[model samples]
Target: MPETGRREPGAPANVPAARPADDPRPSAPPELDYNGRRHRRAMDDATLWDMARRIPTALAQTARLAWSVDRRMTATILVCQVLSGLGTAVMLTAVSRALPHLTASDARTGLTQAWPALTVAVAAMATGSGMWILADWATRRLNPKIASAADLTLVDLHMKAELSAYDTEGFTDRSQAAEIGAMRAVDLADDAKTLTGGFVQLVSAATVLTSLHPLLLGVLVLSVLPRGLGGVIAARIDYRVHDRTISARNVRGMMRWWLTTSELADELRANTMRPYLQSWYRAMCDRVEGRELEGARPYLLVTLLAASLSGLFTLGMWVSLAALAVSGAMSTAIAGTAIVASQTAGRALNSIVRYGAVMFHHGLYLSDYHTFIGEVRSSATARGTTRAPAPRRIRLCGAGFTYPGRDEPALHPVTLTLERGEIVALVGENGAGKSTLIRMITGLTVPTAGSVRWDDTDLATADAESAWRHVGLVPQKNGHWPLRVRENITLGQPREHGDEGVWDAAGRVGMTEALERLPDGLDTLLARSVWGGHELSGGQWQRLACARAMYREPAVLVLDEPTSEMDARGEHLIFRELRAMARDRITVVVTHRLDNVRMADRVIVLDQGRVREQGTFDDLVATEGSLLGELYALAQDR
Candidate 1:
């Protein structure tokens, strides 16, 4: 029978209907489809000449980084490189000078005359070898230090970036690329050294070859040009693959984390999700592998063509040298010296091509690092000079927030005031703007429209650091830090009161007994057993989070679903403590547990990003057609 389908009730007409079981159309893997839609900004193709032109800039940047890390090592490496080049030059010159005498008909007399030149040749060779050893020693020590510095810089940048940057599109991908670039900083340094050494060797060999016959220098250039072109092409292909597969690779990493992490272990097995997740992982792997293999095809072809052309040019070069020697246009000794110089020059050229390609590849990543750093710096929050004191009142005047790339605001403009010595309950369904409202009240996010003021001070123009000092927040999803029990409670900021303050906060959340039962009391590490630490149950962790907030004892306290993980007794104890603590500070609690609203001094009900009702719990519950009353009655029935 011919397939037919009808759109589900209220379904958008534009939505496509499902295909039949025997449909012949092929479907792309989800990962591949996602990868295709991403906006890739990979490095573009460049000619060998373009790469050669940019080499000096990359070398200079590497030099500056090396000098900044350790000037003494940089100077030592530079001096050794120059001396090594000079040694090669002197050795070649000495050999050329002694060749004729050593090959003369009266070999004994010729040998006697050649001893001085031979001695110089041996000394130059020894000097070159010594310099190489010293340079290698310095490089081994210096490269690690350079890499460490790069990583530190990147980490510091990440720490200072604004919280909103993490939510921005493409930000995570950029950060990953920057991290890769930072890790390869040492490789760039090593490549710079190789490039410098290759240039010196090329120069030394070219000078000797030119002295023998100018035509040999031309032949040397022709012999290596093909390889250089091939290298540049290969580098472009590699970067293109890297750029295109970033999203797929990142997805694979996330899936691996999901599969391996303890947080999802029980649920994964209970839901029988391993096979599905593994299949997704394998799909991503296959896609990445296919991309890599496809990228390698052109590189292999280029390498073959380059090698073949290079072989032809090299044979012609040797044939020309032999012709000159046989025609007596050059002496046998000069011809023999030319052979050694040609080989040296050829190797130097090959090194330049190989290292230059690798260096350029690393440079692309380095550019990503620099670009991300610049972006982070630009997006970083600018702290105002005005200091903010502990506020007695927080006022939101027509405040609203719209996230990036979205037309509708997550929070609608609604004027509200929260004053000292009041406990306000924010009651709302999911996506009713309760969390967004609390974030605004705490000054965690700046309002895109209108203003938020702490007393008389506008948060937008106040020092964020100073303002945050007065705010204590227990978010819906709290951090599970792998630190000591005491450190977790204090959040690494131990006050002068120390354990006294920690214990007081723990007591308020009824966590003192739980903490005391641990093997090391307050000193016990809070991590999984495999890590030589003890993990806490979900409720215990929630108590720890509440204690952390209580320890701060700030002027403004915000709790979002803080008691969701606790039992009835534990939840009652938390609310009783919050009421007692609310006498001196402003406390805002966001919860769906409508029964808890009776303890609040005032209740604010939100629906669809707007305040729908406001009053005491008794008054709202008594009123007719009240959203809070309706919600509370529904909760009672459930």
Candidate 2:
């Protein structure tokens, strides 16, 4: 009810860290700047080399994830890849043998001599192709399962995170990073598959080259080493740039959203906000592009140099093979096989380098996801597991609360009791802690000092789920669920209620007639985005929120400015129903509407996070100089 996100109501100086919000881990040491730009973590030459070195480990971790999802598919891919590599080697050997045989004899004899070798070569190619296809098929089947497992991990962490964790701005950044990281986990898997295939092909080519001539092996290594290293360095540069620009991207997105969202569209157009927004967007885009270019500049030159060096090495290797054939150190057929093998090896090595870089980039993001999940577990607010039974009364004794990193308290130490069948009204000015008090009653927040107890059980040590089961809240800003009319009211509560129960709750809020006018009644979708869906007015949506609370039938009900958008008739009807509803449950209402306070059994006035006065509405109204009397008089004057 108190704007559930981490908002510092009275304090403006408490800034949360900029690191991923959900990552509870300590921040890494300061990053080293490169090319006059700051990055999330420094990517100096040494660090880049270190990250490149870790690619193999990262790829292995990704494979483990894939193996976990489908062991059978993983095994199949492994077997097929090994067989494919062997088949490639055998095909190369058969080609070498057949070529020599075809050229060594008379025409008729040459055909007879080459036939057996050619048949062997064709068979090996067919087997290798079949194995390659099988491996690809298995990898595709395994990818979605790996992604699903990662998604489930993220969802579990999201649901378990404590409300207090959101008090910091870092939580949002970290949560977004984690969400993106979840998808990266799937990329990591794809990278693993690519690495596996590439490694096999590289090994096959290398083996054939070594068997043909030892000198060719040295040429293969020289050709690939520079390019592979350059690719890894390039990946690190791109990742650092992307990570540094996350905040800029967030700013740009928010600026775009301001112009695009339906809530702001009309006002923005009326106020001529386009030019201002465009200027801000341009600034963010400049910042993003500058950082990207700075990171990429160092790699572009290295990449071009590597490409040139690779071309030179490739030419030299081919020349060496031609020389060997011309000098009779190697047969023409063997030299030809070596040439083909060298080209195959080069492509395979390139793939290995490319996929390794991809794995390293995605692996870092995946690590963030894993860390965030751990943080969610450790920072969860509900530490108690003892289930509390439904209570006749709840008491706050010397309870106070101050948001983390804030000097000023949101709520001052105060004592209060809410008993069944009592309707209490909390009246206050803006930031008077009315909503904070309501949240305290609902167990959404725990006090910094003293305790809030349900009957005799301290809420901090009670099962949060059980406490929630007996409470219902209609927040200041109700959610607009993209669901059917029936599902919207019954979102949180179990499906104990059928259509009749839904209508009964709606009837109590005087919303049944409005619902009945719908094309599909309870079945109508509430979202404007859905085809054939019906949209409700603000007051109508407020009534539906109230209906949801009524349907819950909880022991405690907390309503924060529930009729802020309702018409006079609608507000009167709701307050009347609330009075009747409170006859069997404890109702705590925070409102600016003085007329609604008239129905309360008692009224409590709050000023600056402290209780200023308390009495029946009539008594407070009669008591001059009291906060409640002043507010009531002011409302009447207005």
Candidate 3:
């Protein structure tokens, strides 16, 4: 197939563009410099202007990230912040108007006196203060709601992702990064509304101050520049620190999981590796700090120097205002207004600096997150609506598939078929595309070429869930749910965990003995953490999984070494039960155990993704000139 941008007739509508990892360019990094000196990257002035112009758009983009939770909360918070700012402006003017008249000797304005103005000024401050407090409160409350939304979204993404997506090695790294970043991004997005309000208030205050006296307004605005620049500079340093610290952070997060979780508890205690893990953790912490200090010290030093300069500049502006007041160039009221305006501007500047730093880091991770999300949504949407038919037999015509990171195709283009109501065995060594073929057969991965047809319907043309309804796969690893024994057995047939079906499924695999040992029989919890719960042996878990496939009763059952953990008696029992169940369904069992293979109605020998031979058990041995015959001789010797 050519690398055409368009989807084919049956391909998903939004088949994601498969980007090569080696692409030289990722997104452009921030312009802020590090190493105690500026290192200007190749960004044009127009680009700077464009990004500056996009600040409002970026703020709006930030707002959209939280809009799913409560649009009203975000709007209300911004409104409150703006209202406070507007009130501050009016109050400054009212008080500035009154102070000059207070010092005059019977030279009061005809409209009003100093006292009335002072009262209005106080009232305005009180109102503005209330609005500010309200905005802050709203911002804090939004965090959990936004975080919850993202958590649920991530869970859905992970669950909905097609099984084939995991074929790539990089998926693990990206998934870990996405999981941590998505949580962080949601948290930051929640506070974005407050930042928006604060910015609105800051601009509003500046506008009012400029009207008072453009000169004083300009000087006040300049007072915030150093800190704003300092913050951006500091953020770039943090980014550099992050690159060096990833290994340590990865180690720390891993250690925390191992020590705290039940998943690793058995291995940790059995191996007695606690001391080694603890030592590794201590080393990680030291390295984390060392990596940080390499770039952070210079950044901190520069930040302090710039902050000191900004503070001195602010003091000078105040002094200039006071001198002008003494000379009667400006009234006492206007002078007071200047002082208030300067304070407002200074706070506004601090906010920009603080938020700029946050946005920079957030933006970096967000870029990666957006890329992943784009692919997921595209894949989900592309699957479209699937509807498949129950075909009498499945056909594979030159079907091919390759794992994302693997060099060779997992399943080379080879055709095979299993007629209805037959037990077909797939015998091959590991990595011979047996499991991969099963996954493709189960509709977890679409073929890269050719097609899988169920009688008349093409399986690839249908969506995963719809196509999978007629198929059941018990993977090589026992995929047992940590729920009740009955629930685990009835996974594929939730509603039909009907009383009779549950009993039938349980009774078939000899799980009755295990069920009776539990406090509540079939309803007993399989995981230890649940109340009155009990654990099952490895063989017991495998039987329960088999019962699930039986309950579903899908037309096609692909059991990849389903009895790997079962003992001799259990294996014989399960195979006999399967033979009873296969009267009206096609059963494909992949196994290495020749004893089990003998029971299969037909054995298909696969070596390196190609069918080497196929025949009944006795017939293959009778040939006396193949891999099957050679294997049997070795088995008899053993």
TM-score of each: 0.85, 0.83, 0.83
lDDT score for candidate 2 against the true structure: 0.80
Task: Judge candidate 1 at residue 140 and give its lDDT.
Answer: 79
Local accuracy of candidate 1 as per-residue lDDT tens digits, 1-638: 12224556886553445556896432223533253432244336465566676667667778888999999888888999889888888888888889899989999999999999989999998998799779877887789989999899889877767666777888888898888878888676677787888889889888877877787778778767766666666667777887778777877888888888888999999998776666556767887888888888887888898888878877876788788888988877777777777677767777787788667666667777888989998866565778888889999999998776678888899899999999999998999999888878887777889999999999888877778888889999999899999999888455768789989999999998988899999999988745789999888898899899889988999999899999998999999999999977899998888888789999999998889999899999999999888887888898
Cα lDDT tens digits for candidate 3, 1-638: 12223334775443433335774322211122232211122112123344355455546555676676877777777788778887787787787777777767675452357878888888888988898888777767766787777667767887787666766566666665566657775567544654565576678667776787777667776677776667666655666677546645755787787787777889998998776666556656766777787886888797898789788887887788888888988766777777777677667766765665455445544555666666666555146455777667888888888777778887788788879888998887777788777776766777887888778777776766777788777887876577887778767666554668887887888877778778888777777844547788888888888888888888998888888899888888989988888878889999888778888899988778777889898899789677787887787888
Among all windows of ten consecutive residues in candidate 1, which has the lowest summed lDDT? 24-33
Candidate order, lDDT descending: 1, 2, 3
Worst 10 residues of 2 by lDDT: 28-37
Against the reference, the lDDT scores of all candidates come to 0.82, 0.80, 0.71
Deviation of model 1 at 128, angstroms: 3.4
After superposition on all CA atoms, how large is the RMSD of candidate 2? 8.9
Question: lDDT by residue for model 2 over 411-438, one digit each (tens)?
Answer: 9998999899999999999998887788
Which 10-residue window of candidate 3 scores lowest in summed lDDT? 37-46
Tell me the spans in candidate 3 whose CA falls farther than 4 Å from its real position.
Answer: 1-58, 101-112, 136-142, 168-177, 236-243, 260-274, 289-300, 381-386, 404-407, 529-533, 636-638
